[model samples]
Target: TGINYEVVALMAIKTELQDHYNVLDNWDINSVDPCSWRMVTCSSDGYVSALGLPSQRLSGKLSPGIGNLTRLQSVLLQNNAISGTIPSTIGRLGMLQTLDMSDNHLTGSIPTSLGDLKNLNYLKLNNNSLSGVLPESLATINGLALVDLSFNNLSGPVPKISARTFSIAGNSMICGVKSGVQPQQSMSRSHRIAIICGATVGSVAFVAIMVGMLLWWRHRRNQQIFFDVNDQYDPEVCLGHLKKYTFKELRASTNNFNSKNILGEGGYGIVYKGFLRDGSIVAVKRLKDYNAVGGEVQFQTEVEVISLAVHRNLLRLIGFCTTECERLLVYPYMPNGSVASQLREHINGKPALDWSRRKMIALGTARGLLYLHEQCDPKIIHRDVKASNVLLDEYFEAIVGDFGLAKLLDHQETHVTTAVRGTVGHIAPEYLSTGQSSEKTDVFGFGVLLVELITGQKALDFGRLANQKGGVLDLVKKLHQEKQLNMMVDKDLGSNYDRVELEEMVQVALLCTQYYPSHRPRMSEVIRMLEGDGLAEKWEASQNVDTPKSVSSELLPLKFTDFAGADESSVGLEAMELSGPR
Candidate 1:
């Protein structure tokens, strides 16, 4: 159903721009020949490239049309009143170099696809109502020389552009050193002055003063290390005692933080393995100093919030230490390691967490997240939930970790973050479509985790080596379509597993993986479906859980527009065929 790569590219851009401009009325260019369009641009050989439609007053939802502009090098749709999101299709525009949508009434978060433009040097998003954090993915483009994000409602710390052409003027909430209005940076500078002035110098005392200041600074500056419990309590000011440690002490525990003790690597740092003096072992995360605009504040805020999280299923924070350059987080170590490790290792070498173990893990993880989402005072959203981050204790109970990107939402409402930072394949569809992260996003990742547990394959893998042509879900869908689902179960589970139980799990997983977030089940509902079908307990609770409930209004929204030709009520015969019961 896809057009030629070139036509697909052209259509994608036109569709996106049209949607942004509300210009999609009767837009039926059914063929691949975009050269015939009044709004399109083309090169000498008829290869579609560049789309320049300035101030068309185009209004409507952005179409997937932008994917039509394959050779498109520049898209200049500045000065329009377009009021929709940029489509995910635009990211497929591999050759796009300059995108100018400045001064448009475009609203919504910036697309992560824009980060796919490696050759992009000019990005003009100034004067729009674009809110949220700038995509750090865009920072991967070191060649970008011009970026005008001025006058937007952007917030959070900024990134240092290599070309130094980054502009953040007029954005009331935007913050960064390069943007010249970062409060945190200004505070650090003021603190530095205070330290230098108070600890004065003389020629003979100068050398000693410099050494003392350097050492003290090294001891004082805290990197946004993992959850350090001591940082939560200042014994001199606060009442309760906090588990605090100096950078030197942490360095000593991990043998000067040796590589041999590394637990895992992360977005802003590396997590090391360490043991406490009380005969307990822990995982310590060390923050890497990337570009400072977004890094330091994010680090600081992360440490502050995570220490306050107290839940049985939540990863416990042992402590943390901050030095001038080093930030380390100490966490109670899990004996079985991560879920991903178990999935990868040979069962004989390191026992593959069995299907039953995997289910309990998923259920426990859902409950943990549900507590974060519904139980916490300021409902927290675990933005980065995945198998790798889900640690397993000796009993295989999943403990969701990583609070660097965690967010606290107002009661009963969903939490939305600026930049979309999540693993591929696990990211929710709506998040990719609109940059809205909610409890639903975590739910989507949990759904993928469910599928992973069943199939023993990566969420996005095609698995050609396993003689499968698509992801595990794709294989499952194909099997259902081919009426061969019984054959699709993992070979490891022969007669040992009950067929009905497997079927039920697959159904729950499929519901979780629905294309839209609103369509997917909430974690609470998911728990019910898995534990016992509380929604419709009539479902067979066997391992196959094979019962598909009746299409109630809550279950599926089936409208005439969903089927082909059903909306053409006047066209009797075709409409009748389309309207027939599914």
Candidate 2:
């Protein structure tokens, strides 16, 4: 009787590992399917998709037979006592996204074959006894988001990798200095003394020449320092966890901010794609019209606060650079770009974001906003929340970018600014009129973002194209009320989406974008509603209340024909400083 290939491969893996806690006790070879076994997750087709056995007290060598599971997407076997070489055959799992084998006692050189994982997003092999030169192939994987190989016995020069985040700090043997031929044997004592006397005579001459050169260099350096924005700032000062990069480094990374490398342009500045010397990919945002009055200390303080607001859903500040005439913020390059770009663009003759991914993006963006609003120490108000600011990681997970940038730019001002900063249609009514923005301002934008995700169109552009008098929000509300919501969905989704989920999402969006800020739900409440809790009650309550006359009459119209000339697929809109309605 023939056995299933996956079952045979899994049994082979079980045979090699010594599971002391009996975690693999149920991994019976007699069973035709290994899908039900603990630590194993399978797809709908019964193919193993993930194998998670972390901290299981498992030991022994990993079997080469693991390569047989070609459909595996994740393999997390960290925090164990696994020994012996990593099987080179693991490279066969082409669909792998995450491979974490950290905090283990694994030995032998890392297999060069690992570079073959083209779809990989995260690769963690830190805290291991792995040795030998780092493979150049690992640097070529464009989809890799992070690669950590710290605390290892690895030697040789580190390869420049294309990952957004790459670390090899704890590997003492890895360095940039190359080995060279050693000097000849030491001279006799008499010969050494003669040489020393001869050197003494030359030392005086050398010292005099060095002093002249030093003085000349100091003069040039002082002149350059005068033009530095952070003139009094020490490069060594820690700006929280952020790395302070030199202006020269950034210039070289972005090819002197070449126009060809431009990723996107915003009201604040233009963002350029860059590749660091270490081969890591990054996005460098060069701010325009930076206010130098904030001074070095103030700039550092503001940046430190922004860096401290760390969350998985928030875009991490990789580093930053400041010069006399420029201010730049460095962030990890998002491979899938922003939700706005993805919505407008197509892949392989179809929409980039499918119905399921769109749903995931909606929930993920909400969670990120929740972190900024309620979880952060001082409670960060996004000020600008829209599809463009929500970036997609390699795995298509949503990461809220530019959360604290408004505060960074307007450092001297409070959250309530006299000059409003936001996109046109996405800006809240109260914010546009009064220039006083609260968390509810962000809520209003999030509501529009939901509609954008649903329709796969820019809010302003959608209104123009449809020639709808009330704008995208009004059209959606009208369609929703008339029970014709099916007409509002993105045509690309076809019949793939669930009708009930679509109705629930539209209801949530309507509740969030109500005319009155007080009627909008908090991010925490929004999350609950998205997860299928208390939405109907909130929607019903919102309906019973009539729109406040005071604010409804003052609400700015969402239509803007002037912006129609702008690229619909652009990553971000220019931040307009609104004193009043145009």
Candidate 3:
């Protein structure tokens, strides 16, 4: 009966929250326990112990029934649109240790009942419209280690607290002046007039001198400086667990980026394997074109977006380093290398990736992209989604890396325009001609990635070998129509793959790479079809629609060529052979 109560409470809580992306679709009411739900975690005895759903764009009010989950030790619901007052019943969770409800539209005063949580260690209620005086009861929590109430409408003098870190910045109404401070006396009229006259004269002289100095400095520098001086000083770089390493530290770690330690090179940068002083292995990416006008801006944007996007399948940023002449990002080293390397290279004269691993990689990569496009606050578009950018961890799990060309799209906007970037064969036709990109563009590239996985060959190389003017995609369709897919399978697989699964994967790839971006399915839908849920229905619908012209025939003729005046070695790993209209 107690467990039944917990389920009922969870169901009530779910009713109050909006799930925009069908993320909570699997939270079945008929389930025996709430522990099997997507975001709910349970203890050894099957009591709900945690609820983690961050950056999911969830809206609506938090249900007070959440307090019924007395076993909950942590609750993370940040980077969302949830609003309304904090449920006072939350104070009933005696075991709660971490409570974060930041970056939302929530409005209300801090609940005094929060003080009842004796075991609370971390409390974050920042970036909201929360007002009212700081609760005095908060200072009474003996085990509290951190308290952040920044960027809100909080007012009044702060109470003395024992927490190791406390932030109250951005609250303009906060009174920092202690009690019993005397006010200053007014100045005499004659003294004020004289002071004003003196200040005005001094200001004029200072402006004249400063203007002359600025002209001289500009003449000497000859407009060489592209980035703003203030761009290098982001407080977020040092906040939280992200470290800010010095240039000297990174240089020593990779032996000054020796050629022998190079892991991979792309158009934007080169990745070097580094060994930290703490005896940890790391991959250091040194960006090129750091002196270009928008280089630093791109670097800053990537840092901010990647830091916020936390998922197991996406590459985790360990730290970063930036200097006047150098920009570098640090990530954990992958032992299994990139998917491209594994498929193309062999170890001990045998294929490194088996048929089973290939299917898993495809699904894992889709889930990561799904999170980026649907779950994140500002949807991310990976302009380049190829096998080279999909890395493998020790356990052979796919980790999507390389955010050099990634763009963030607001939920209200559907697309963004920029210069043509990405590999030749992977670039979507619409993106190539119009320079406009959306999540569909990523879907198109992922389709190419799927073909890469199936045939264990590079798209461009396979296209060239086919001798077909319509490129690799056209050849794939031709094979599928003739029931000759077995001939196109990777020779390394040697008839070891499931025939039904191969046909399903091929159909999904064809659907994804359609010439019309509107025809491509969203990553979430693709995931379902891949998992054997809706492929038959979607494929039948696609077949009913008028078949568009071949993917390559719809675009202008393209010829692979090197970027003018670009070092061949500095070209992007996936974009080495860029294509231009010929």
Candidate 4:
């Protein structure tokens, strides 16, 4: 059977690996079923179709036995320390659609055998030490839409591939074929002689201009830290369904950048409340110091992400504006402001968020995250998920905003590694330590937001005394341990909220914040748990609130690194600063 073949195939792979982090600990050779193993995905016919173990910190060579599984459709092992040559046998998989081995220490030339993958659509072999000319057959794959072979030692003439489908930049040695209008040969001999003389002078001028252009290009390249948006934000090419606004219009709307119109300021820029000529109220985010590192990247990312994202629960991107000195994003003004502001209002004698509204907000936010993590064509991971980013409409419905640090995860790959983003207290431990952010990292942030909703505590309590140094997570653990979790409930609500419902929500939050990424439930499962179901009831029974776990022993010590004023709560447009590609 295919299962037996897959089981032995995986065993051979495990046998060759170093497994430094024990990520493959669950891939026990003695296991009777390989389908049940971690990272293995089986088809309906019980044949293994996928093996994804990206960003596991794994090392060692990829075993040739991996090609033994004929039914495999995807093989993703990116973002690890795995080294060695591309196995030629990989080409034997005729059904393969994705073969991602990027961001590894892989050496040698890309296997020409990969041309056998007739169904291949995405092939990413970037950021490796790979050498030699790319196989021309790779460009012949009919269905291939994306092929990234950048940041390598590759040399020779690059294949004639469309600019939209291939990325061969960053290879110093690779030369690209020129494509343009051909010169005319119909000129007379005298005209040709005159043209040659003119050409001689033109060539000298061109050489001088070329030298100047190269120097200018190097200067521009150094100035741009992340992506060179010099050509990325061309509305005619990249913008889809997103309105492009003129700088003059937005400048006039914000009343010539009046301080009174300013709503907030953060690491990225300032946000101002503006009234358009059409008398429509909108919030405009103006990138602070447009020349700063990663600023342009953030602006481009927000427009790109919000343009692609379409969800009622997510904040809408109305349009954008750009000028030589400024970049701005426009959005519908939220009259009720953000959840963080509402929580602060409640703390300062304002009307508190009722239990029903809080529940609705939590549920709505989860649904939005579910869409980002699972429903999006290329799954998105919201690296900066926080209460401040969750704005509320006048109807009190949640609107999850700020996708600047959002990452588009490939359908076949797992997680992506980048610089750490997100608020201090809301970041997951695994992400903080390894720089890898995934759907689970977002879940951790959501868990923190849940605790904030239940207890009305800021993610980072700047005013807490040294003795009360613990954040909301610590307080919840402490109260639960003392069998007084009810004490952690928002005191503003008194006894009006249902004790049973509150306790169940707390349990779900705790589960979502589990230390290990795999231990956290998916956002979809979380929604099911929040809404009373078999899983919810079973979880409630397992917790048995009457006898809670001791917080001192069960919980790890809450160690918070002070981001000082960097908490999202302090920012004017809290979501804007964290918006950008990681």
Candidate 5:
């Protein structure tokens, strides 16, 4: 039964997706009923372009017949019990976008014939006992975006693609000249050496041809992610305009990253607050688990994918470090800390997050999320959106942070299957149940933070009234039942607020927390709502207009800090220990 009918059973999870399964109903490999389900996906020519049930929890070698899906774009099935060599005929899948066969107990070196797949974007063959000098031909394929060979018994100087971008973090025997952000002096020396060598050995046009070919190769590889054929990036583009820095330079600037330099910590990494010799401050992030449990390849891929992409709402990537095992990132330090700590919960035991301030923060955060989900090239899904992840600058401007679980999907793509990964109370119900994360997941998390801002409550509080709603649903229910909705307001505020604006915010919060993901508004729509529109026309019509901006400028330099009056050392690592009037 190796690579056979058992694979059909796995498809049974969703009745709609598996309805056409004909073979597994009878376990017959030769039956016509199983043909379509065996391996399927339609192509431009009205034919299947993908199929594979490798291991499929089956216990036998794959049949050579597996080669039938020549037009296939994806073949995935590993983490199963199966044996024997991979079919060299698999090289026929010229259109394959992804092929994974990792962790199966298989034998044999990878067939060099696989090099013929110029369109393949992803290949995984680690954990198998394959042996051979790794394929050099792979260096020629520009379409490949991911290649994994860490656990295999393979050897050879890793392919020498100039400044080869890869992660060999865990494999002790795997070695290569690891890349890093370098000084201009080294770059200048290499350029001089190359110029002298070229003067002695080659004519200008011949070198030009070689340079053009090298560029074309890079263009091909980038197509896997930046797949459009015509939008090639130029090597002369100014990276200096990005104004990034080196991690080593940052280390020296921050006293070798003293503990006192730590300003914040989140799911993705630790942020150390540093002041440059010239007195300019920055946040240096040394990724906590550079060798993340997920795998170092993914770590590098994440850095590459997110770094090059820019958005004003995103915390800018000042620079990065990849020397030895050091995987650090530097970003401009947001002087005001995170929104959770900045909101001055109480002023002399009274709420300092007045109606106006809370409203502004809400709108600011929505704009940032909107930019990520709706405006970027490949839309970004910010998997985490709690108050802690929303950082603020001196002006109380919000910026989204900690994009570890963020995904950059094709502009038309909507959701992807992933394991549940988010703080409790902030995760959407569907994500928790089905593991299908999407933009709406961020919406749910944002909704909870909205409540936290208004009520000064957290995402969840078990200490609340017994029988209270266990989550947002419960919070809404409790507020609805209590009748005195005013009681829900943060006590520190003590009604120095616009009741009309406050009610509208609560309604938006409720809309976001509804049981169905479809019910939540897109961040774009949320931005409009927060920008003083459509929540309650009846209220907005009679409500006083927003105060004129003339006097607000005087409010700048408001002298805000997590340790408002306390001196430096008082605000230490145990942030929760900081004592304040609130």
Candidate 6:
């Protein structure tokens, strides 16, 4: 019966509103359940908990029948043409936390009954035609975090809501209370005229200053300036800087992206080494139009992350170029290339990386990851952490690059649901099955990278190694079990690395790749272990007790050949193969 009441309330709202956009075309009154309807979220116990219908272009008074859904916690109806006063019956919703009816044509004073909703946290009634004194009872809601009542015809003293995020600007008539009483009577006509005259003069002065600044900017924009390699120019705040280059200039730099200028290619894009007019070198990444899913979104994300994230080990984004036919990202050139390329060169009889350089790169990459996970505000999780993404500069220092598949997490959030990303063999087992990513997922990828560094092996080599049929993870575990850990070291690094240090690093990698997310050490802890913190002993003792449980019921063999050239766009098509019924 309560479900029916919720359904009826929803239908009444639909009938009252003039839905010009047909956004609510699916709200059929004949439906048996409103919980399944669009924009209606229900609790596990089958009660309507949230009704979100913002920017729906619907115009009408909010139906008072909404109060009948007593279990409602959030009622969001912003950015609509809805008119009339807010239904006072909404105060009956004791569990309400959010009440957003902003940017509407609603009138009348806010109901004092709203004080009854003690759990309310957000109350937005901005950009409306409401005219009356705001209720003082609103100040009593202790949990309120935001209260926006600007751009309304409300008068009298402002309420002290004690909210950290409060805004009442644009409501010129609103005034503050002093000593718990309203201020004195209105000012004299002459006093008011003087205030207006003063404000007008100040506005005119501000405009004149802005015009002078604009003219100076135009003059600078007309000139060409060259910056040195160490300039560290940032365009976000710096005005009149030559931060952006034309597509024609970039095209000329790479000699039309000739094969000789190509640095590397991957599933998403190809990178080229280019020298600008001033002899400064840069790496130009031209994303493939087909595989760059949400191209504009990815472009903006990469720019934002690279610009905001500044560390010695993080690649610096020089700038970007977006044309009708191309999206190009520019970064400082790394002469040593990527870790993956270096490892491949070692396999091809090039000069092998000494043990010291390998350790240095590992530590540097760990620091970059620590910055992303713990240092940045609203931390970022690099969903695609692999050897290919770790570039090496002139001195062979590691610079963690690539943020196309990155996800942002609030400090209070533990994980986020997203499409499965990353190289097939480097993905964490938990993330692969549940589509949930956290810092541990990045740690898992780093563990795979450790294996790549130690053994000089790819994460997913399809039966390439004569002795190993399973992936690098399986081979490392097998070698560790046999106590022949030295056999897992890169053949090119024979006797070049300390036996004791190699064993310890392998053990740390094993600890990081533990199937259970809770069991894996944080990136910060991993950093400590890399710096000789001696936490490997606890990891070694725990290994005997913790068995690797399968993430799914069936253990299916995944082959690298199956995804040899496929990109992220095709991951969803074959997701079922890697992600079993979990």
Against the true structure, whose lDDT is highest? Answer: 3
lDDT of each: 0.63, 0.77, 0.78, 0.71, 0.58, 0.72
Query: Per-residue alpha-carbon lDDT of model 5 for 445-498, expressed as tens digits?
Result: 788788778777554542143244233455564565566567677777776877
In angstroms, give how far residue 302 of model 6 lies from its true place.
Answer: 4.2
The residue pairs in collision within model 4 are 264-572, 269-288, 404-579, 404-580, 405-580
Strongest candidate by TM-score: 3
Candidate 3, residues 69-110: lDDT per residue as tens digits? 898876878888999999999989988877889899989899
For each candidate, how many residue pairs have backbone atoms clashing (under 3 Å)? 47, 0, 4, 5, 8, 0
Looking at model 5, residue 520 earns an lDDT score of 68
Deviating ranges (above 4 Å) for candidate 5: 1-240, 293-312, 344-352, 462-469, 536-582
**TM-scores of all candidate predictions against the true structure:** 0.50, 0.58, 0.74, 0.56, 0.50, 0.56
Error of 3 at 498 (Å): 0.9
Which ten contiguous residues of candidate 6 have the minimum total lDDT? 233-242
Candidate 5's displacement at residue 142, Å, is: 23
> lDDT per residue, candidate 4, 1-582, as tens digits?
434667788999998878987767778766767764556656536678777777678889999998898888667787888899989999999988677889999999988898888877567899999999877766566666467898999997766653235788788998665334445658789998998999999999999999998898778768885532443334332343356777767778999779999876644568789999898999888876566434555566555655545455777778887654567778888888888778767645644588888898998898778767754545788877877789887788788876643666866535745455567667776666556678888998898888888877665552242234444466666666677867777777777788888887887877777666766788867877788655655565545434323322222222333343344432212222233343
